[model samples]
Target: MAFPIRSAVAALCAGLAATLLTTAPARAEKQEHAWTVSAGAHAPRARITLDDSTGTLNLSVTRDGRTVIEPSPVGIVTEQADTSRELRFLHRKNRTVEERYRTKSGKRLDRRVRMHETRLSFATPAGARLDLLVRASADGVAYRYVLPAGHGDVLGETSAFNLPPDARAWLGTYRADNEGQFTEYTAATAPTGEYSDQALFETAGGYTLLAESDLTGTYSGARLAHDNGSGTYRVKLADARVKTDGPLTTPWRAMVTGDLATVTRSTFTDDLAPASKVADTSWIKPGTVLWTWLAGGRPAGQSLAAQKAYVDYAAERNWPYEAVDAGWYFKTDAWDTTDPDWQTDSWMPELTAYARAKGVGIIVWIHQRELDTPEERAQWLPTLERWGVKGVKIDFMDSEAQPTLKWYDAVLADTAAHHLMVDFHGSTIPKGIQRTWPHVMTLEGVAGEEKRNNTAAHLTTLPFTRNVIGSMDFTPGAFQRVGLRPNSDAAEAGLAVAYESGLQMFAGTPESYDARPLARDFLDQLPAAWDDTRLLAGRPGQEAVLARRSGDRWFLGGVYAGAARTAEVPLTIGSGRWLVETIEDGTGGLVRNRKVLRGGDTLTVDVVAGGGFAGIACPWRPGVTTCHR
Candidate 1:
């Protein structure tokens, strides 16, 4: 009697009618401290500048000779019941993590630690110390100080204090496969404040940056009953997608909500508007396809037999821009090639001039960490812009907390001001930023071609979750990698035709593009941009199919997994010419670039293997064969 037929219909008709979604919140804490305008012990090392008129808490931290603003966090922590068993457990966790919290007798107290479970982080540099200039306000306790740059790497550590008793604080998902501090809304049991193992995610890099925020803090309880949790911040292993040349700090922890919420990276400083106003963005054109030039290696003139091969390739393909990704500027394989030593004028000037001659633009990579500093950009931005460089690809920018987000927001505004286009690699999924600032051409939010090494199911599931937010330059479509390995899940032609983004780069070696039969055929007719998009079905990293409308044409893409179910997708035009490219059951096949004019324009195809399918829906070009089957 427990058949899916009756159970599903019953759930749909009654329980599953709401469109609400819940998200998790960040970890926050506050302690009250009495304050006086009078400066006393240690005289508050940095200036505590609070402009009550503008509601900004700004403090400058300094060491040796460097200074940085410790921007006031957007929200103050709301008090939680310390008497609660959970609070006691969390306190026990900290006792061990904090080295300073020992007994005055100079002995470790109780040989036990409290609050050790949810320890966010405690950062103290050698020879540098916590200079807490505390103030009590109706809002909350205001603690401000600086982390001097030269304090022996400025060690900061944060552990999300969790205890065995608090394990239920998380939600459950099929991924990660653990019982951790997550809030899952998709499960029927609806364990409040509990996060299943899959609910947690992590990202780390050169800045020694680490962020830990409980996701359940973002979503509402009612919504937390599905999709496990609302917002996602998962651990990324290989795709060291970002490189930084300076220290990067993350202040914003994860927060979630049910409906259309404005994700504010850091909206402090009136610098935003003047930036939008005073900034010159005349050079940017919103709708052009970008190519991540990391197909193989961004070989220098010496590294290649034909020095101009890159420019030639784009010219042949009509690829408007060539992104010298990751290891571009380096003479060696080093990612942070911020050598004031290397002459930028030659490689940049030569490449830019060359690509421009072919009617293509040149975009090179810059470590985001370098941009975080004003001094670095004083020499960096102008140097590259002076060459024929069109824009810069900013890598590894997902410090979704207050401090780091502010840095990125500033970078976007500054890049716009300087007429430089931006692409955020190693980032979170897009959330409509492209609509706001088209200069942000693309972002690497999906498990892109760089991740072809992972299971195809991961690639197949992205359109549902990641693509739903916005554009993903998934570094896609390598026809040959799949040929080499049977399980490549290389929907090379289909995704290039289907995924909706102004920036779509085919990330495969030139050898792969030339040798692979379908790769050539697809890129040959690739358009610059799409006019409209339609979400066919599915969610991120699960299963999804999307349809995009380009001028006088349309593209239908399918990313499939699970059981092979027939999806009866009826078309509005019902009568058109479709140039279909499909991946059926892990096999390479195409439906010919032929015309199909049918009165009943419906597509019912067998979808199997954690793979994909895609096609262009448009009027067949004259002289093309008719595919009226």
Candidate 2:
């Protein structure tokens, strides 16, 4: 189901044009000066209310008869005029959008999304047109602003997420690199500070995750912040303003809602993004990669023999790639290399050639400064391609401003031209960029394995918050415990399946992984990309259990942060019996077992405190007693 990028874009344009020409004024329910737009023609669905009773437009959201978002201001602020309020409603149009697409790598390879869209048109005091586009699906709600045919500098946005005062939230403070832990707080008790776009809330009605999507280089990235003791998180742009010429459409302000399962499995982010821009995507492949920096420091990474050993390890385990982290170009202090003789003297060419001979690819790391411009990218990227390098891991971006985001777009397009895959480190959280550029495999925005202070609760919370948005390069699979509240060996193994990353980087040293044979064997057989995914059972911060399928095999993983407990996992994914193999934390170490179970049968797994479990199930056949890797 590989879609040619041109055809996909054409189809999308055709759909939008048709919607604009054929859609009529929507017949929404009106009470006084308020209009209600229901997600679907049913109860227990998401709803958005537009109120102008006070001579100003305000937006609110509800789910199943419970208020999720209170009345909040919604509009855009431009240099020419302030459209935030005092706007008169013009007309409204409603349409249904159904799209089916396939991804290069994600929780689900094939994705089908259906959303009801409503466009509410308004006019400023001076007759300038503004359109507030709202979209709703079973899993969430999103809204954006469209200033059609006329724009100047967008000063800021007045859109805000006013949550219920009693709701509990898990929020991450705003950082350029987005490498920080999420703190839990109640809406009233939450500190007033800049927060990431992706925030999770447990409301009385259900779970809600606030996020953004379809963020392009034309707009500066945004964060959420509020006054002291206020539950209204207003949108704050990274830069002061974004200049535009003819037309402008801001990124979507999305709120994913429902139960934990619904929140975890929602594809709302990608649903709002544009289709792929690369026409020939057959060269992009996602798989496991051995990273050198976390396993051993720069010294080990600099040594040619050590790199050769890692290449051998990846080759023997049937992995696709091995990543060489920083310090490959210069010894220390100097981040860039301008000396031409270094190319012949450096070991990268030799290493890449040798790795290629062993059926493995090399991914080299570079500082953001090295490829910050077109001339720099043109100078270095081709040399790496000629050296048989398969990918580039760009690091130290550390900003999401409009110019930086534009640089990212340029880098992706340039790297795609060179037929190279991309992994962004020291970067901002993913905002559906992978949907547009499928070659962008993974992004390191979370406090991942490199941050040894990560907790078991952090691992459990990721599948619901950060990872839900897109592919997360958490770099899981570390057998050795280095962090405070360190996870057990089984939990480390389970992370390989629990976390979704297109390019999963194992952070354990070869010796450490070899000592733990069971975990190592599981990593040897694990698939980096999945065809299907399901949340079996779990909650945020306490535990998480996920089942992902690739081909005919099913892989199940669970992680718990609380006290030791027995997790009863029902094998109810498919329709037949299965041959199951499981590994769990034992009193001595890891315990492995094999059994046969039906679709409805349950497998009881005993996990130690700060521990977890991993299992593989194969569809049963006559005379096949053991599940094959």
lDDT of the candidates, in the order given = 0.41, 0.84
Clashing residue pairs, candidate 2? Answer: none
- How does candidate 2 fare on TM-score? 0.92
CA deviation > 4 Å runs, candidate 2? 1-33, 38-54, 332-338, 482-485
Residues 430-488, candidate 1: write the lDDT tens digits.
33344345576667654566542555455554443344334566666655565432132
TM-score of each: 0.55, 0.92
Give RMSD (Å) of candidate 2 vs. truth.
10.9
Sliding window of 10 residues with minimal summed lDDT for model 1: 263-272
